[model samples]
Target: MVLGAACATLATVAALRSGPAPHEDGSGDGGATGGPTAPQAGQALAVARQEFGLLSGGGWAQAWDLWTPTAQRAVPQAEFVRVNTECRPPVGVPYVIDASSVPDPTTVRVDWHRADTTGSATLSYRAGRWRFAPDARTLADYRPGADRLIQNRTAAGSCH
Candidate 1:
């Protein structure tokens, strides 16, 4: 029985592998269009806006939930929230998601202008939703491009 089960599993795996790969779901997540569709791009922008809303409202933990898996791995949940709170000012000022560029189905670059300053973030898509994907260690370990994306949200500062 065990041998038979193993053979069946092997056959199933072979059959699945012989078919189309998983990335070709045709929703444009990773299909022939080579990038996200217009609607998917718009969805990414909406998610970005939602994140900003959460940040400005002092929803630290909720805001952290918007981060990509990779980013979240760099810090624990409480640490992520604490870092963000300690870096940026309170979010009540007028801010515009001035630009959202979708270079591929999996990635979107978002820019926002708030008061006299501008900030940006690169978001990655998975499970039909966008997550903020900033590459960094601690708050200040940012290269120039990353510096612009989060608009220095991780810069050295006091929460109040």
Candidate 2:
């Protein structure tokens, strides 16, 4: 009974946290849908927060787990670990939740700042939830010097 109550309470909290989008009315940069679903926005924020938290704390494996299925499929576990470990080593902590922008009802962009630099990510609404689905450009060209032409590169562990 106690466990069930706790679960119910948590669910309620989650629902409450997922309030309506800034532009809940049928018009705004938020998109074609009437508005971004509350659950989607909350889920995206929760996932982003958790991932950033783990990454900032240097828990590479745990942070990798926070990634969406798509991200996991795109980058292998080893590669994800390597990337986060290398790029976010000094990311300090994911202490700050920078402002969020709903470019379209289907997309929300969240930016994070470390000690001296910043990183931004976008989440898209899919199946009634906010998910990480960056554009082809972002996925293929994360690094500044990465190849711009990433059409059909065949590699055993290629993210593109």
Candidate 3:
């Protein structure tokens, strides 16, 4: 199962690199790199790609490291490990972008699928970058009864 998940992760990364080049605002004056202005949607896509790379490379710590701070605050590493262990799907072609859009400059919504599971995640732009979380909403907004697509809410774990 781990092998399959790893494959999935790699496939996802490859898909990302093959897609359109990402554009971010070069707003950071004075030798700053990877600045904001990169649309929130683009930033979310990049984060997802990095997460997949971490998983594919047997770098669970790195993969977890890619999660948003908000996500980290919401769910810890132990739970992340547990959920990933249970949810890792079988190896298949990496999930396509399915669809992506920014509801607002600060929020990005992406619909993604792998084999049997399909879901969407909401990301927020912070520090001029994007981070994934449970839609940046109230617990009630994330409740299964409230949103059907929020299949998982596990956050990124620690680097170590």
Model 2 backbone overlap count: 3
The lDDT, on a scale of 0 to 1, for candidate 1 is 0.58
Measured with C-alpha atoms, the lDDT of residue 100 in candidate 3 is 82
Q: Model 1, 12-102: lDDT tens per residue?
A: 4344224322254423244444554333665566556656665655666866777766666765667655455556565665457887777
Question: Alpha carbon lDDT of residue 4, candidate 2?
Answer: 55
Question: Model 3 off-target regions past 4 Å?
Answer: 1-40, 52-59, 86-88, 91-93, 135-160
- Which candidate would rank higher by lDDT, 1 or 2? 1
RMSD in Å for all candidates: 14.4, 10.6, 9.3
Q: Could you give the candidate ranking by lDDT, starting with the highest? A: 1, 2, 3
Clashing pairs in 1: 120-149
Q: Model 3, 60-130: lDDT tens per residue?
A: 55565555676666656555554444444232335545888888877877888754557777766654445
CA error at residue 155 for candidate 1, angstroms:
9.8
Cα lDDT of model 2 by residue, 68-143, tens digit:
5566576566765655444444444334667787787677788877665576887765444444554555445433
For candidate 2, the lDDT comes to 0.54
